[model samples]
Target: MATAKKKIHYAWWTLVALCIIVGLAKGALNSSAGLFIPGATQELDILTGNLTLYFSISSIVTMIFLPIGGKILAKYDIRSVLIVAIILQAGSFVAFGFSNSVWGWYIFSIPLAVGGVFTTVIVGPVLVNQWFKKKNGMALGIMGAAGGLLGAIAQPIVGHTIANDGWRAGYISLGIAIIIIVVPTVLLLVRKSPQAIGLKPYGADTASAVGSDGAKEELDKGITLAIARKSSAFYSLFLFFLLITSIASFAIHIPSYIQSRGYDVSFAGNAMGAYMIGVLLGALVLGFLVDKIGSRNTVYLAMVLAIIAVLALLLATDSKMVITLATGLFGFTVSNSVGTLAPALTTSLFGSREYSQIYSTASLGLAIAGIIALPAYGYVFDFTGSYTPVLYVILVLLILNIILVTFAFRGKKKLLTQGHWN
Candidate 1:
């Protein structure tokens, strides 16, 4: 029977499905947030501070509910969750088009956060962990890189749509498109586990399962959420998580930040494109490099690139060439924010036993950073008459990130040796 059954690998198919789902979800939604900010403000006559508050509200919801979302994922069908998630997130985006009052945005922000947790945050890592036992970092990097590729494709289209179709029509069209594109892919290709297709993880052969002691060996798993929560390593990882997110959340404000610097709106949009393209390149490089050089060292290199990038933006905002170079560099550096640390660090410390729950709980850092960082950057510009302060602030965070990650890994080493952990 084993010889007769045809063998097919689900891992590659899973990658394709992720490239499509994640590509569409992030490329369409995140890249388009810039397009909506101005329109939502102008059409509703809302202040920039309050309009941005809506995004913070959504982040707050995500932060507050991520653990709940994790527990929910534990119980439910991923396909069904993803379908509903895409609808709520993208659907709420579409609802912004029809919104007349600020109250509409505030209300829809609830489901939007809940949905985003499922589709954007938890889905890729969880699914990848289930499918690939080897080269997991590369898988995560590819997922992040796909988002970059899609953003490259989608942002210009989003810009064009907002420029030509008006914001409402643009939102409506893209929202519906996200659902139309992702739901079918999810239903057709996404399965919760490799066993659903009659396979072990890509490299897990029974031949390798026996230990020298004549005992059956099992895969080492990650630290449970409970233990991870108590350690200095977790807090260090948390700070790194926060710093990286602040860097990316700062992306949402780049177009506006560009405008504040006496540059034209068109230039701002183009700079964003440059930034995302940089992110794409960086993701692929870091993912590949991490496997070769190791995760901690790769992080150091990326952080240096990010610091240089942010400093360039501070000093060279007027030069289109320099700003473009800087934005791209920063994009590359920050792309590793999602691509590398969470899973790599998790597996390095624990193994995989409570992988999903541990990662999900830690991801509250992401949600919380979005809430605090987004408007903090905006309001800095609002009150201070320039973004220079925030740029200086980001420089500090990047440096601190390097320290945090170093300490987190160092602590992990101690934990492993002491037999108190790992």
Candidate 2:
């Protein structure tokens, strides 16, 4: 008798683990923070713009720590680093429960950002790059989709919890719950690399040896961090990071934006749920598109989708259908720019030889956008009593990103001609 064998790749297991770890951190905790803002300010009598300063403070900390954190990840065990990261990130949420003063957020934002620099910014792409040589773009997309799926579930629950129990209980309960779930998963599943498990990366048997770093190799396929930094491609990519983040940071303000249009919190919650659905769909579609069409083409398509989303919001303010559709479209197209576009762009531009170092350094734009853009939007709304001006700014930046993408690829061609991509 012949027996059938079941086969499943360990890489997929690692990806699933990441989906949970990052999903809870980003989709649950980070995504839900905006829901807390309204309640926190109303109860504490703080101004919206003033309270948002804590976000900027967190961004500043993230900017300072990203490079340092990349080094730490390369040195430490993934399990140990992530365990500590979850504690800091989730514990800060628990601490926010007791906060009466805005200074508490400022104080807590330090550890929060420190932890987030790893869990949110650095870990996913670094690990995905090391694990999957094939379907790398698709892997990044799945991670984004997971975050969206989890966030879709979390947004409404958090909103309902805040509406019923108040933000204090909501914060403490959600924080503690996430810590309990994520810690064990990290301890059991996550590893720094396929090599640590005595296995080559997924698709290793058939793929190029470009990543293996044989001692006798005469040339490298990717540029070094030193070379990458010196090129115009680097700056253009940095602007892409900055501009995309600045545009997408509007998601954090979606609830506020909806309310300003005379919608209720429940409607805002539903709109966010729709947005997460868009994220889920967009992540998958963009990931597949990048694999089929390449990163450059996928980015052009995402920007076009973004333009339509922004225009819908501008022209159709009176219709609930239009607002929800626009918001969902915004989430689908723009939100994944940081998660999927940034890492994939890094690979397409420079290859994966110095991926961690180059990606981390380039991602300073992400942190810088948080510090500058997030609060700037809040302050703009505070001053003008509308998010209208912010939308105009985002539209301009989207157009500029299209131009920047063309320039970055031209620089890559320059590097190739110079024999730097050996």
Clash count, one per candidate: 6, 0
The lDDT of each candidate is 0.77, 0.86
Which digits, one per residue and each the tens of the lDDT, describe model 2 over residues 195-288? 8888888887656755455722433458888998999999999999999999999888888888788877767777787888888988888877
The TM-score of predicted model 1 comes to 0.83
Could you tell me which 10 consecutive residues in candidate 1 have the lowest summed lDDT?
210-219
How far residue 152's Cα lies from its native spot in candidate 1, in Å, is 1.1
Question: Which of the numbered candidates is closest to the native, going by highest TM-score?
Answer: 2
- Deviation from native of the Cα of residue 309 in model 1, angstroms: 0.9
Off by over 4 Å in 2: 1-11, 67-80, 125-138, 187-219, 222-231, 351-358, 413-421
Q: Write the per-residue lDDT of candidate 1 for residues 1-422, one digit (tens) a residue.
A: 79654555788789889988887777668665865666666678876666777789988887778779988887998889899999999999889889888787789888888898887878888888888877676787788888888877777677667667777887888899888999999988998888977778765663345333433223444466777778888888877777788877878877677767776545665677777787788778876777798778888888888888888999887799998788778778785666565557666655676766777677778767888888777677667867799888888988998899888988777667766544
Model 2, position 322: C-alpha lDDT score: 91
